[model samples]
Target: MSKFKNLVVNLSLTLGGLFMGVIIGEIGLRVASIEGYQKIGDFVDSAPTSFHTAHPDLGWKLKPGASGEWKGEGASFVRVNSNGLRDDREHTKAKPPNTLRVAVLGDSFTEAIHVPVEQTFWSKLERKLGNCAAVKGRKNVEVLNLGVQGYGTGQQLMMLRKKVWDYNPDIVVLAFFTGNDVINNSPKLEYDLYRPFFVYNASGKLVPDMSFRKLAPLDRNQRAVSFVDRLPSWLVNNSRILQVAKKADLDLKKRQISKDFTVLRANNFNPPKDAVWDNAWRVTEDLIVTMRNEVVQKNADFLLVVVGDPIQVNRDPQRRNKFMQENKIQDLFYPDKRLEKLGNREGFRVLTLAEQFKGYTEKFQVCVHGFDNSVPCGGHWNEIGHRLASIKISQNLCQQLKQSQLPKR
Candidate 1:
């Protein structure tokens, strides 16, 4: 009898302890969430309107869209549907009865931050191109800015394959930024599984999938945890942590990182000779081949526009030279001079803008992600910079168009 009583008492105590622990853990998590909310509030209070909109949980004033005007804490513009392309009211769509649909693909440079939709390179290019009699009266050319900020080549490819492909675009202009595209292609601690969320599966259906390569060994729970961690806002706002981890991951990158990491580094940047440039090249080559094949299968012309950063054309040749000299890092821009050689070898249209806009760097004290005057420092081009880039790109496109029309030899 006493033994049975003791056993019951022990079981009760154990159960009670577990119950208490669970309750405490729940309270702790709630406290953490509240504290997190406070931190987010503080962050929003100090951040810019753009920053707040990007992170609404951080105490940003929200002005919901009313009567087609979408006003918010930082943005003064309203969102309106202009000829199927959602743009600001200031930037009207091309007078239709004329419709030339062009899709612009890339990262932030293509997205055109810190500038109004009218000022975006796409809008400006549309205005410039639509005015031409050759393009005018013949259905106004509509440039769809499909550029999402912080997307890498892989993401861009995925986006194009899934989202932009259905548009049946007349022209697809890929603005390739050389600076961080390589890095973005690589994997890190906090992977953005959400960015390239929708991928066209074998069935030709867009399905939600994580961007990273799958690990066959991961258990269901582990996969679930990874999925939760990759939530859009969670991964994006916490990107700083990933950046830090990436910088520190140089050593363990080989064994722990995905093959795409090595591939992107080798083909996109200058890797050390002993480093796996060959492997990287093979991977990128495969990706390019697959992308090209897809383009061909779709009967769409694939044009590769090689865009470089200010560092590529800075007056101080030694700016990049130092990194090369110290780390023996080769210039990824000229990876085997493939981008250039491929243009000549494969007839791929390549537009190198490093030298074209080199002079404009002087107008701003900082180059490649810094504020000129009081603007924030990041890779995104300022309004004027974006305009200049757009003009240069438009001129290139015009030349390409003219060349395409010429009788084939």
Candidate 2:
């Protein structure tokens, strides 16, 4: 009986010690005020340290000289060059002798972390263009990928000014993703304030808004409450050690289950529903024109490549028709057509890929947007999609260059 009582007392003491340790650790962490070790929601959607770092103007950029295994719908070992480009080759600010340089810019699709650097559209385009008549006079073709994940058109324009002009690209290709670029450009629509935004002033001109850099770190109030809500809210909120541990656990789980795919909603591909969306579209168009003007000022040819969303290129006609019908969307090609018209009106070349991709998907009946690790028909472009993009973009550029004289060496 004495032994049993002693055992109970010892167990109670051990529990008390653990509880005290936790309290002390929590207090120490709070007092230390270590960044990312703080409260919940402080670092939500924060870029991985291995791949990205915060930028003053662009908000987030690929960490220069960083290499990591990117596991999304598709998996690849991605490396960022010293210039923060996702390329295997290093580039100098000056163009190489007798070489034609093409700078490709866009968001995640152009950055292409889901596939190998060699297999990306821009890399493949470089190789493909080498054989084309477009580079008949040039000894080499260099395609510089200035793509970063989650970049809006506004950010791409900023990138052109800050980084791209240094390389002296003879041509600039803007790979516009119809998926969420409209929302990405609009401050009113995109809630993430870490990135740069362009807004229209009272004078009806596009004004750069870099206010996000000066703003305090956004609070978690905007984030939807998740399973964490099940825990004691006060305890979770107050305990920094607990939040750090929870974040680590979640990170581990995410790494373990890396097959999560980003399947965008139907509305993302549809026409504007309200004035906010209308403004987003207008701002996106203005941003594109701004990019064109910059490229023109540098005496570089600009090609606006309108990338088709997965649904627009779905192989199954029934699925495509059903999605359009259910969504009440008159045309799946609406965004593509609109951007193409903008390019035409603005005197910049446009290449719309949705109709061609739809035909290719129907003919080949192969998955372009996903991988074996993810849904076969959704997410970022797979190897086949990249290959198709390289083929089409190379062909288009070749034809354009054939008609127009190549930039002088």
Q: How many backbone clashes does candidate 1 have?
A: 7
Q: What is the Å distance of residue 173 in model 1 from its true position?
A: 1.1
Error of 1 at 183 (Å): 2.8
TM-scores vs. true structure, each candidate: 0.58, 0.81
For model 1, the stretches where C-alpha displacement exceeds 4 angstroms are 1-86, 89-98, 188-281, 313-326, 329-332, 359-369, 372-378
Residue-level lDDT of model 1, residues 339-373, one tens digit each, is: 55755765566676665555556445445433444
Measured by lDDT, the strongest candidate is: 2
lDDT of all the models against the reference?
0.52, 0.82
Q: Write the per-residue lDDT of candidate 2 for residues 260-305, one digit (tens) a residue.
A: 2122245566677878878888899999999899899889999999
